[model samples]
Target: MRVLMRVAAGVLILLLIAAVGFFALAWKGEIEPVAAVDRAQFDQELIEQGARLAAVGNCIACHTVPGQPAFAGGLALPTPFGTIYSTNITPDPETGIGKWSEEAFQRAMREGVDREGNHLYPAFPYDHYTRVTDEDNRALYAFLMTRQPVNSTAPENELPFPYNMRMILAGWKLLFFEEGAYHPDTAQSEEWNRGAYLAEGLGHCGACHSPRNRFGAIDPERHFGGGEAEGWQAYAINTESPAPIPWDQESLAFYLRQGWHEHHGVSRGPMAEVTGNLGLLPDSDIAAIATYVASVMGEPDAERQARAEALLAEVSQSQSPALVDAAPAAAAQPGSAQGDGAAIYAGACAGCHDGSRPQPFGGLPFSLSTAVNAPNPQNIVNVVLYGLPPADGEATSVMPAFGGVLNDEQVADLLAYMRERFSDAPAWENLVELVARTRSGEHKVAIRPSDGIERGPENVGASGGAED
Candidate 1:
């Protein structure tokens, strides 16, 4: 009995010592709050620059609910662990960052702490924000402070025990978070370096594009190798990009600026919001981002380039004035399961997708669809069911919802047909289950319009809406 008691006491002592050390390491001192500064004090040019940076960061999308005032918070961000509500960033004295000084704001951006020194949840993406420069933070502060003060409080986070504990985040930081501003690559061009800075810091593109580990931190081994965001797959912006037509810098920039590419369909889901926001930035910045992303993706191999060339040629030939609006090619037998999907496609989809009309309005050919060619069918499923909606006051792509029209089995069948007919990749499994889950809201889908503002004739269909 005495020996057992000694062992328990020793274990208890070790645990207590570890606890003391943890508190010592995690503890942070609160900064003194300052009075709200007048908006007039900040320069107009600095505020404008901040606006562009905020757009790049996509701060408004996460911070504002659809109907609420911008940056007033209360946006519910769903995570694997739980839903975390974004805090009000407006300058309201009672409920917002009105009391937070420039130093406090900078600390929050750099270290993920609040004015009171409370550790913030990683749902805020501070893990990426930590790379932001002090100068950028100042600009952001100026922009945020100048906004109309809104009295709002975010709902309490719905995290479970241990995960909800903020002190635990200190350990997470130690494990994954690397604090520092972006360092330029001396070997790369000035544009590439600038792109790297914006993309790695304010853009926080990897937060969605990269897969996460069991602990919810980004997995370094497969960075930008594709991951999920709000139920949509952020396709690999790296060499593993599943786009049948490999993206070059020109295409990427055009897509980023105009929100659509003739070779690649319009941006929908969360990406639509990104493109919409990126419109605030200058063309040079957009080009820089494209340059950097293309470098990361690297050049396609000779085989891939040849294949893409072949596809482009085939599509080009098909779109000739003589062949335009011709009947679609025949499919599987009428009574078979594949035939059911083919019949549905002919009735519902072929009119637009068979390369009859111009693009940014007409549906893209399945051959050029990244969603169809992707490893998973989640995006294609989402698109088929929810469909794209028109952007308000803008000429954009529009597709009607089939969720109410098609049953889960039917949707699965259609997807299977598309998979077999359009892509050489393996067939998707459990598509019926996926369709059902997405339809029932068990897998929440964030459907947004393909809201790219049209940029005139230059921005229209590439290769004149060719079919591949």
Candidate 2:
């Protein structure tokens, strides 16, 4: 009985020790709140700098619900664990961060803690934010604090028990979080380092581009290899990129700035929001990001370079007046799936995507599209089904939605045909199912306007079908 009693005591003591240690790791003292500062208190220059950084961070995209107060924060972010709603960062005294001092905001950005000392969920992407310098954090604070405050509390996170507990995030951090400002590499150029800082830090590009492990931490080994965002495949920006034409710094800068490139099609999905926001950044910053990203992509191999060159030459030749009037790619045999798909493409896609006109205002040839060559067909499926909506009061690439017209089998057949015609990549498996899920909204997708190019719409996205 004495031995058993001692054993129980030992167990209890160990539990007590663990509890203490856990609390120690998790504990953060609340900072005293201060009255919201007047906008005049912050320097105009600093606030403007903060505005650019906020754009880099894409804050409005996540924090602002459509038609809602900007930065009011009611956007629902769905994660593997559950839906975590964004909190109001607006300077509302009661529900927003109005009372938060610079120190409190700094702590939240650097340590992923709230003013009240609760551990923030990783969904907030503070792992990347931790790399932001104190000066930058100050600027961000100034900018957010001066924003119009709206009295709104985010809906409670729908996370189940244990997962909903903020304490568990400390464990997650212990395993995955590395808290520090970005360290510059001596070997790299200043431009490269600047790009790296912004891309890896404020941009948090990896949060969406890099694949995550089961624990929801980015898989370090496969950084920038590729990942998914909002039901769309964020294609590999690294050397593993599926883009038939390799991305150079110039092309990347153009794409990032103009939202479209001749070699690559217009940005869509979450990336569309990114490019749209990036417009606020200066050309230098965009160039730096492109430089850094291009370095990450590295130089293409001899074989790939040769292929890209050949493809560019081929596309150029194909777009010439003589070939423009020539018949489209050969039709598949009649009474077959491939044939039906070919017919559909001829009627609905080839008219715009015929490579007869330049992109932005013209359809991008499938041969150059990253979506067509991607390992997964989710992006292409999305583009085909939902198409690009024209931006309000803006001239942009517009594609008519085929979801209302095409059935699952038809869409799948069409995509399969495009895959065979445009890319040497293997045919996608279970495409019909993917199309069905995306169409039925079983797989949720975030749709945004393709407003990258400033050119007036002409033949771009013309499905060659009668108006609805």
Candidate 3:
């Protein structure tokens, strides 16, 4: 018995020592100050470099609120726990990063620790920012310094118990964060490498596109395979994406630059913000991104292609030609229900979306659209309630929120008209319910057609309208 006790005591001592050593290492990992960049280094060239980096990073999409100073930061991002507000990134002495030394910034960017050694929530997208080159980091820092300082103290995040604890983030980081700069692929072209660096590092596209684990850390195994943010379904950018229409490089580039296309889908929800920002980048940079994305496709497998084709054919065949022709004829006659819908469409929707003028940033036209033909009208109803804003880098086209302007009945009537006139699907009856659910913030738009019931033409006329 005595020998056993002694053995247990020895094991206990060893365990205590290990625990102490582990904590000591963690403590040592706290934020450290670094050498400051000389004021002389803050030149126009550096600022320009920073601007380019910012474009790649798409900083304004998250940092700038509508009608607010660029990068001043007041965007409210919702998560599973609660809402977290973006901080003031401007170089204000009190509210922003004015006092942070270059080393402090580097630690935050690479190690996910703030200047005060507080473990920053990964909501800042620092996981992907960890891959940014030091030079680019320096340039980004310089550029941030040049912005006008705003005295905005962000609201405290309303996260649940353990998540609110900053120290716990250290453990999360230990599992996911890797300290390093982007290493160019020797085998890929210079353009591809550049695209990779921008996409993975400063751009941090994976922050939204990549799926996350239960712990909220991105699942590296399923990189860019779709995720959620701010109640919006951020779809996968991978080649294997189940989008009804496959995204070619040209269409992707056009969508990124413009915001919409005929063959590809339109940007709505969070993607609208991304496209708005990407639209501002140089054409050459956009082309580079396009080229890199194109390289990802090496002819989809025959089975997948066959399945997609079969699905499309099935959807096409499902519509009745006689009903499709008769529905429009009924809509054309004055005093008919379709006529009421037409009047609503002309009065409420025709001001901006008539497809006659080229949409700013080459936005897709709404006339005779598949989105309109959808059986589920929830997306359309939601859009009519909350108008979509143009993405950060794209052409400016603000769809005004009609939540206040149109009541539930008006929205439903308008949608009914559009569907009957433009499509052959059944009318949507769940529109009012969908609007209530969406307005109450109960549901979000689905990312893929497979995720929910396909919206049909009849439902399109019944539900509401498309905004994105």
Best by lDDT: 2
Model 3: which ten-residue window has the lowest total lDDT?
448-457
Candidate 3 residue-wise lDDT at 311: 52
Candidate models: Cα lDDT each: 0.83, 0.85, 0.64
Error of 3 at 332 (Å): 12
| Inter-residue clash pairs, candidate 1 | none
lDDT of 2 by residue, 1-468 (tens): 343343344444434544664676758889998876677899988998999999999999899998899999989988766789999999999999998999999999999999998889989999999999999999998899888889999899897655677776766776678999999999999999999999999999999999987657898899898988888889889989999999999999999987888889888889988988898999999999999999999999999999999998888887765664444336656678888898889888887887766677667888998999999999989989998877645543377889989999999999999898889999889989999999889889998877565432445544432233
* Cα shift from native, residue 146, model 3 (Å): 2.0
User: Model 1: residues >4 Å from true position, as ranges?
Assistant: 1-24, 320-329, 394-397, 453-468
In model 3, which regions exceed 4 Å deviation?
1-25, 28-40, 296-381, 389-434, 442-468
Poorest stretch of ten by lDDT in candidate 1: 459-468
Write the residue-wise lDDT of candidate 1 on 1-468 in tens digits.
Answer: 343343444444434543663675558789998886888989999999889999999999999998799999998888876789999999998899999999999999988889998878888888888888999999999999999999999999987654576776766666677777888899999999988888878888898899886567899899788998999999999999999999999999989988888889888899989888999999999999999999999999999999888887777676664553333336756777788888788778877776556667667777888999999889988988887876755443477778889999889888899889878889999999999999999899888766653442554543443222
Off by over 4 Å in 2: 1-21, 320-329, 395-397, 455-468
lDDT of 2 at 403: 90
Q: Estimate each model's TM-score.
A: 0.91, 0.92, 0.70
TM-score of 2: 0.92
